[model samples]
Target: MIEAAFRVLKVLEESDTPISGEEISKQLDISRSAVWKHVQELRSYGYEIASSRAEGYDLIASPDRLLPYEIEKHLKTWHIGRYFDYHDSVPSTIGVAKELCRNKNPSELHGMVVIAEEQSGGVGRLGRAWYSPRGGIWTTIILRPAIPVDHVFMVTMAASIAVARTIRKFCGAGALIKWPNDIYIGNEKIAGVLQEISAEAETVNYCLLSIGIDANISEEQLPSGVKTPITTLFRACGAPVDRARFLAQLLREFETRYREIESGEYHTIAREWKSLSLTLDKRVKITTPRKSFEGEAIDIDEYGALIVRKDNGKVERVFSGDCTPA
Candidate 1:
């Protein structure tokens, strides 16, 4: 019922003039009295609706909260954010997404986005602690793709591409994709992607693609002794870009790339990913559990694995590891 009320409010918001209750009732197929009841309900949700004799109703202001109405207002993708679960504060968006996948129907919940304004216990890649301050964009996207388990890593590549493209589009064209899911602006890290999946023997059930972008977070908010190098959109661009707009564009781009992957168009994204890659043709050091090698990143394979040609005339394809350019 609250969602229905919000839908009505959104219609009123798009209109240049006021909307009458009768018109709303006719459009929604609800009675005038029901529309009045929904209006009252909307008011309780912190929506200021102007009710007068001349104009039936008008939306004055919506609460500055991360509600589905606000998120959907800026969202542009068809499936990426069709369902949203927003929280003022949560332990972790990825945690919530994982729990949702277990309890709910995964097939019915495609593109469900979990967003938190503040995360109390955010987790990063490889069990690292992620500092999710209030101003940053901390969110996770739930996806159910029918792809082979081996190709699941492509989702992380898609996310990295999305974040890098978003930063470049908003800030400038200098943004680049660091190896293994990090976005870099010059030398400082601006964002990162962490892809978690639930799978069976040889098939993936669902994937929780979490992305953390330092939009307006300050340096003081970061923890001590953990600084590799970090930069925010505010610091890079001299001003804070609109988070909603950036998220919208990011989701749209991600959806496009994700669909391409589903359609076996990995070569297309691979081409773009290579062009935008910061690791390609650069001397780098890759560290894995078994061994570490210093080499030059030559290309990324169709499976999104990094291919590095070492100094010893040996070529290696890395599936997952930490990469640092030498």
Candidate 2:
């Protein structure tokens, strides 16, 4: 069903006029009833297929779901998203990616993306629960980076820039990256990134970069007692967004930034990140495992550490922490 259905879909997609069931069966080497069954299966997945005894079948419209076929149709990158795994619901995309890395070859899994429509056990930074209801983007990309382990944090930095730029281009929102790896629209949070790595002392085995976005989810879908101000693209744009297209743009942007890092262009990422900084020059609370303090986020270093100037006039570099703007 998987291979033949995709083959049938590809033929229909490439055709300008409606394709007859008999013609599709002859081209695909399957029975006419098989073609009809696959078309029904595709329609159940939200593909609008028009059927008539005279005109045969025509592709009317594709759904907004993040199906592999939908993403692959619009994706233009070489390796990023070249191999995709989509699920209607899962505990976590990060969890699924970790299992794939453990069982399969890490190198082969590079540039692969795992997506879930809903996550029941999604976890964000510091093991906090991430609310991943339907109508959002919950995905994790597997990478076998050639860069040093010290520079691995830059992957998240690259992802941050990608998401920010994609939102600006696709949704027309003036999105900015909050220090570390969070996307914000003005003062409200719209997206966040969580990165996990399996690394040795100096080499990285594989990296799982997870990204979550509240694309079409409404404010009412979010649970109460949330700590920070949050927002969705639907609210910001006054309508639902096409999630599949946005994801393809993000993967392309990320692949470009990732290539830069692999080629040792740290300054390029640093400069772009600073220009899009939402926390710079603002008073923020930085809480690390050791201590907490208030400071102004002046800048970020080449390796993506937040350079903070404390109230005591002392400067410190924080590699990882929870940054909250006051």
Best by lDDT: 2
Give the alpha carbon lDDT tens digit for every residue of 1-326 in model 1.
88788768877888778889998899888898988999998887678889876888988877544567776667888799998888878999999998999899888888999998889999987888888888889999999998788888888888888888888888884888987888898888888899988899888899999999888777788666765688889888788777777888899989999998898888888888888888999999999889988998999988889999998989999988899867
lDDT by residue (235-260, candidate 2, tens digit) is 88888988988899999999999999
RMSD of each: 3.4, 1.5
TM-score for candidate 2, please give it.
0.96
**C-alpha lDDT score of every prediction, in listed order:** 0.86, 0.92
TM-score per candidate: 0.84, 0.96
> Judged by lDDT against the true structure, how good is candidate 1?
0.86
In model 2, which residue pairs have backbone atoms overlapping below 3 Å?
none
Which number leads on TM-score?
A: 2
What is the TM-score (0 to 1) of candidate 1?
0.84
